[model samples]
Target: MPELPEVEITRLGLMPLINHKVSQVVIRNSSLRWPVNLALNSILKDMPLVGLQRRGKYIFASFPIGTLIIHLGMSGRLCIASKKSAVQKHDHVDIIFNGPENKILRYRDPRRFGSITWTEDDPYQHKLIMSLGPEPLDNEFSADYLYEKLRNKSVCIKNAIMNSHVVVGVGNIYASESLFQARVQPHRPAHKISKDEIKSIVDAIKDVIENAINKGGSTLNDFFDVDGKSGYFQNEHHVYARKGMPCYLCDHPILQITLGQRSSFYCKNCQK
Candidate 1:
């Protein structure tokens, strides 16, 4: 699944082409759980795209009428391509723009988990966006907020941070990497962790996310930038997916554990 950094990077990549351009919205395949074409066409036909932004893992395209909210579920990605290019498989949604350069933006989701919807008043009022916590990069997600949220919580630190209610878009892979960077054991109880450790965890989250954005996000399989290039963050993994391999820092065997049914990787000697 694409996280916040991945989604933000996509928004940035798309802003130049789609912003201020009148879009020709086409929802090719909307037969999924939620029929998107009808809603998308009805709302986006004449709306000029004002800007592009992200909240958590969702991408928001502002328009005159409303906001277009996109969620790249487990295996979904949004790509930008030329209008004349031959459509690829699973190219569900296409938003074409007749700019001076004549470019086309496409949304291709092979797994069909991605979705498109429109919101009039506030996108957050939408059911999917309503319950999400603050963006991980926001000031609201400071160390004090994290410490207060984890107070008296008995869940493991990894699970605590991955909770969307605590903070958005700390997915399994990034969570493990951030924990390892902060030297926090994955299985440590949340409340038992010190305030200093919480601060470290907050800093680690920001650091890992910034690093991933700089690298264009981890392209484990389906993720790609507007240029259709894979992200380079996976190359900098400190502990994620290196289970049973030598830890980079301590040379100890990198360990793997399951938390909240998600596989977590950390260095047993270095993290704890």
Candidate 2:
């Protein structure tokens, strides 16, 4: 799935389209997680794109009359392409813009899990985004907040942090990497973890997530930036996916375990 970092990278890649007028929306397939609303064609025709921003894993394209909200579900990729560019098998939707330099904003997903939904309603108040937890990179996700949220939970701390209500965008890959970095055992009960460890975990989550975004996110099984490039951050992995490899800090074999049905990698010795 495209996490927040990957989504943010896509938003950045589409920035060039801002301030341009929508020429039209072409939908090759409307059977995404949510159907591409047929009404958007009439609503967004020639609407000036005013801004673009990301909240959690969704990208918002702001316009005078409404906003287009996109979610790149498990295997989705959003790219900026030339209007004349050859469309491929999975090129599902295009928000074609009318400007000499701007490109066609395309959404593609082999799994059809991604969505391109529009709202004349306020984008921030949309049902999908209204109840989301704070962005992990912001002060709203401070250690104090994380520490308090986990105070009475008995679930594994890994599952707790991965909850979007607790803090958005800490997905499976990042949850493992952050817990490993913070030296917290993934299976440890959330309420039983120490305050200090909780603080460390909070910081680790921010660091791990920000580092991935700065590096353009991890690309495993089929993530790519708008430019058709796979990410290099996989080289930065310390424990994630290194099941039997030597630990980065303790030299103990990195171990892999299943938590919440997701593969979690950590050092048995380095992470307690």
TM-score of each: 0.91, 0.94
lDDT of 2 by residue, 53-89 (tens): 8999888989998888988888788877786678889
- lDDT, candidates in the order shown: 0.79, 0.83
Please state the error at residue 243 of candidate 1 in Å: 0.9
TM-score for predicted model 1 compared with the true structure: 0.91
What is the overall TM-score of model 2 with all chains considered together?
0.94
User: Could you give the C-alpha RMSD of every candidate to the true structure, in order shown?
Assistant: 2.8, 2.7
> Candidate 1, residues 129-218: lDDT per residue as tens digits?
889888888899999999999988999999999989889989888999999989999999999999999999999999998888876634
Residue-level lDDT for 119 in candidate 1: 78
Candidate 1 — what's its lDDT? 0.79
Q: How many pairs of residues collide in each model?
A: 0, 0
Model 1, residue 137: displacement in angstroms? 1.5
lDDT of 2: 0.83
